[model samples]
Target: MKPAGQTHTLAVVGASTLLGKEILEVLKERAFPVARIFTAGGAETAPDLPVLDLGDSYQDDVLVEEPEDSEPDYVFLADRLRPAPEGTNLGLLHSAERLAEAEHSKVIDLGGFMLPKAGGAVRIPSLEREGRAPERLDSPATSYYVAPHPAVVVIARLLLGLSERFAVESAVGEVFGSASEIGPRAIAELQKQTLNLLSFQKIPQAVFGAQMAFNLLPRLGRGRTQPGEPAPLERRIRDELRDYMGGHVPLPALRFVQAPVFHSLAVSLYVRTREPAPLAALGEALAAPGVRLRRISEGPPSPVEVTGSSDILVDALTADPAHPEGFWIWAVADNLRLAAVNAVEIAESLKSGGP
Candidate 1:
């Protein structure tokens, strides 16, 4: 295991996009102890953000100048291996897999490069071939683990901590993905079309299959599978949840839909409990640490309202007398922020020793 209380250095490979920016924000918000921070992106100018210039490699412990006082640690190829200077501490990777090949003291991946298996151990066929498995790490020390999307992981941990009687019956996710989720070109097109007044005469479908302005696309990536078949994202979530819950809880049925909003993701859950759960108790339970509960009388939650908010907004906690088993509620969160924050939390958990 890695030594505790060690000052670490972090490098974010793709730090130009919204998720990347949010990752920086979350790290600062949490006040994570860091000796240096490195941010790399494809863009020439990332205004208001401090990033290292990878123009050339510096000697061990060398410091470079930025426009401001802030600067990153070092720059490694997204997939190429670049060793940090000897005696370096930990690496927190977000949304970049190639960096995993780097020769760091310890690497905490925020991408889904590895999957937790039905059994206790994790599966990393790719890393295994490269001779970078759990066993490779000095027994119990210097171990590496893949962390799943932060939002999903944190929510799973929160729910498991709350109660065992509650079952996530069904979940509907309205994802307000950032423009960066698609790419830079797609973002440029969206802005161009917005200025052009949604006229298809000039703009063509680029990032998304359809023109995504003043309109919402229900589907993302591709078509949903058959009724019984799970969508790709949904399947991943179910599988990961089962692994995290350790089969102690049942997997919830899920539905995912994409909205036109620029950022954030909102999910509404209808839970069925083994015993009747009162609305007040349910609200209080959800309002526990890692979740934010909102109370509303008339209108439903929307993506526009919840964008840029860190907490998972939970409202519409209404008990269904017809369905005596449980009740329903709405939850909203900044998807990228949730993902970024959750990733940091997982790293912290692993560092502290997880349950």
Candidate 2:
């Protein structure tokens, strides 16, 4: 680990993005030490944010047009840069590569795109052993570190926690994703669609390819992600869970549905263990750092209530009547905030030279 007072230089690639902004907020909230900070992005990014002059080739250097300084020690690809768009599913791997090579910075991708296209180490701070670094983190070949999708984190953490006490047989999960998961464009389209529908006007469907105001979609509309394939979000969650779970537990059967809400993510999970486990014992296992257990009397959590909370709010625990080993769990997490926290925590671990 670096010395107590030592600091590192940093940069955020999509500083103006929803996740990018949240990440900055979390970094500030956690008081990450920094000797300098830099930012870059497309037209939507703030005018003052420096634009990196990355040429067409990987051989090109990461040239900062303003705020001349040495390359940052770490670079965070927080979201996709707009206008010069790098599609929804692939992210800006080319840009990330340039930043990592030319600038010589350790790149951490929060953009859900990188890992699926190109391999990387998945980091979930909550799951790591207390002090020892995971082998992936210590490996020289791992160039990028990824923060798992919020749904993946919630499901993985819950199952991992439960497995500590019971032998989990299998599980199934239904994730309700919100507009903000797609970024500001989707949020704006949903808002516009809502207002347009109320006014009896034709609703805009450009961003989501359908009226997303009050309707739910199994996948995006026409011109958006195709219905024949696994939704990108679902694929992402599945891939992440596979890596994070690391064969320690059975991978849950998952379905991702796009919900009308503008923020947060919710999951309804059914878990079957090898033996019947008491609710009291399961609750004890579920309570841990970065998680909140709500009492049944307090009512089930809603996406709205979990919007700003960093902790994953879990409640509405109940046992299945027919299957002695079966039970259901309902969990809600601030989509952006949970992801931001996980990213920041990963940075902290990297900063401290720990897992």
Candidate 3:
């Protein structure tokens, strides 16, 4: 191990995407110790850099790994997470896999490249107190650490808190997604579609493959799978939830819908408990780290309200009218901010040896 106070070099692949921008902002906000920062993206799409260009720097292996020395302390894969059309935007995934195989730097995956069985540890620092965040973050065998989907973090933390205070029987979540979850392309498409519709012109459907403006979709029109098959986003949430929850609580039944919004995520969840859950006691239990509880008098939390917020906002917590043992909660979180904060926290944990 190197000296404790020695700052290290870092690289962020796909550093031009929305998530990449968020990660860089968070790193600067949190004042992460970095000797140098390098960015990489698609050759044609990447912005021009002064000297540390990806073409010369990344390919030289100096940014990825040193011959007999350790240089880059971390490599973050912050690519567009929403599954793109097959054979599109896969260069970052290739870089992540190569870095993981090299085991030179601690690779943190903000992208969904590392799956449940990929041997990468799924980390949520907010759950560290609950013994849910992985303990051995710097394990040699596990070079990749997955910063889970923001929805997974929000749902898992809420369910974990409830399970700690009551016997949770089952839970159902309706998660509303926004264009920012895909990338800048989806956001541009949505904006263009909205303008075209208002002006009575042809709308673009390349990114979303549907009329994303003033519309709600159960699945994207392009690259759609067979009936009953969960979309890519839903499948990612389900797989990561299971991996992180570790069977400690009932896995929530999830449904993802694409909403005509630009950022953040809104979730409507109904949970059934083994015993009658008192509203006051339930609120006390749901009060966990990285979660903010809003009063009913404050109305419900909205995606706009939670933008740029690191905490998941929980509101409209009420008991089910017919079933005393059931409750409903509406949650909103800045999808990029939440995931970015968690990824930074993971790096913090590694530095401090906290988890």
Candidate 4:
């Protein structure tokens, strides 16, 4: 928890995109102790509000004329910058090279890439970076360390204290990523494809390989490289979980599929635990702090129900009597919101003490 009475100043660069906009919404919804908020964008298409013009250089802090507004204290950069600007404390919402040359107050990078030796920013990778030893922050560590995927964070939190009870077996995730996930280029392509029907019959294959409309892609990330190759995001999660749980827990076999829906990520876990954990007991465990267990007596949970929701919904749970050890569970959450919140939590934790 944040220290009492201490409000934090925040700035959100690229506030126009899906992830960036979602971050702002989460901040507002959670009632985060924000003293001031600054929004910046590259193009004028974003909301008509006060913003800071970077103009390709980090030196100048020229404020755009606004109706009567105040200055911001901290800034969250959702835009892509090779090296962050100088002077101000930054939250690296996108990946970039080392900006050690700049004297930033603190930097929280959303990209999972390894940081330079100088140390200043905190790298919060996806659920994949969980078990690995985090880079040390020599200077004032950034305010947040976060992942952009909410389902990952919620699942991680759920498993945090319950690692001893069950063992995750084969796991599958269905992602309904927002338009922002592919950025403006993909959205523009999608819109263009939607507008012209007769001659412009082009398949949307830029951000996602296949046409995403009314389709499902079983493979995501760089696809299967080779037999011995790493299992992209899913593999990373399993390895990291194993590490975080101190190897006492079994790593899950994961399969991720991309769905056509927008905004949320839903996951189904098929676990083989040592003992049979009743549905009531499992529900009680999921109801623990930070989770919103949905009580569903019927069909499977969908992305539409989880979109925009900050809480991770655990809907269905059942036992596989054949393999008495088998347990099935369902989970859903807003990827952007959950990821940003988890990153912020990490940032706060590092700010107070080393993680």
Question: Looking at candidate 3, what is the lDDT of residue 48?
Answer: 40
Residue-wise lDDT of candidate 4 within 1-355, one digit each (tens)?
3426777666565555555565666565555676555554423133321121111122122222211132343445455443433443332322233333334424443433322333333233322334333233254644333232444455555554345344444333333444434455544544444444435676656666566655576654345556666445555444434434344444455665666554467777766655666767656755554466666665556666766556677776777678776777777776666666665655455445444
Number of the top candidate by lDDT? 3
Q: Write the per-residue lDDT of candidate 2 for residues 241-348, one digit (tens) a residue.
A: 887777788999999999988789999999999989988788888878777888888978899888878989999588999988899999999998888888888888
Task: Give the residue spans of candidate 3 off by over 4 A.
Answer: 1-4, 42-71, 80-97, 130-140
Candidate 3 per-residue C-alpha lDDT over 196-301 given as tens digits, one digit per residue, 9 for 90 to 100? 9999999989888889899999888976776779998899899888888877889999999999988899999999999997888988888876788999898788
**Which candidate model has the greater lDDT, 3 or 4?**
3
Better of 2 and 4 by lDDT: 2
- For all candidates, the clash counts are 4, 0, 0, 7
As a TM-score, model 4 comes out at 0.66
Worst 10 residues of 4 by lDDT: 50-59
Question: Model 1, 282: alpha-carbon shift in Å?
Answer: 1.4
How many clashing residue pairs are found in candidate 1? 4
Q: Which sections of candidate 4 miss by over 4 Å?
A: 1-14, 31-79, 83-104, 113-148, 164-180, 184-200, 220-232, 235-248, 347-355
Decide which is better by lDDT, 2 or 3: 3
RMSD of 3: 6.9
lDDT score of residue 152 within candidate 4: 44
Which 10 successive residues of model 3 have the least lDDT summed? Answer: 50-59
Consecutive 10-residue window with the lowest summed lDDT within model 1: 50-59
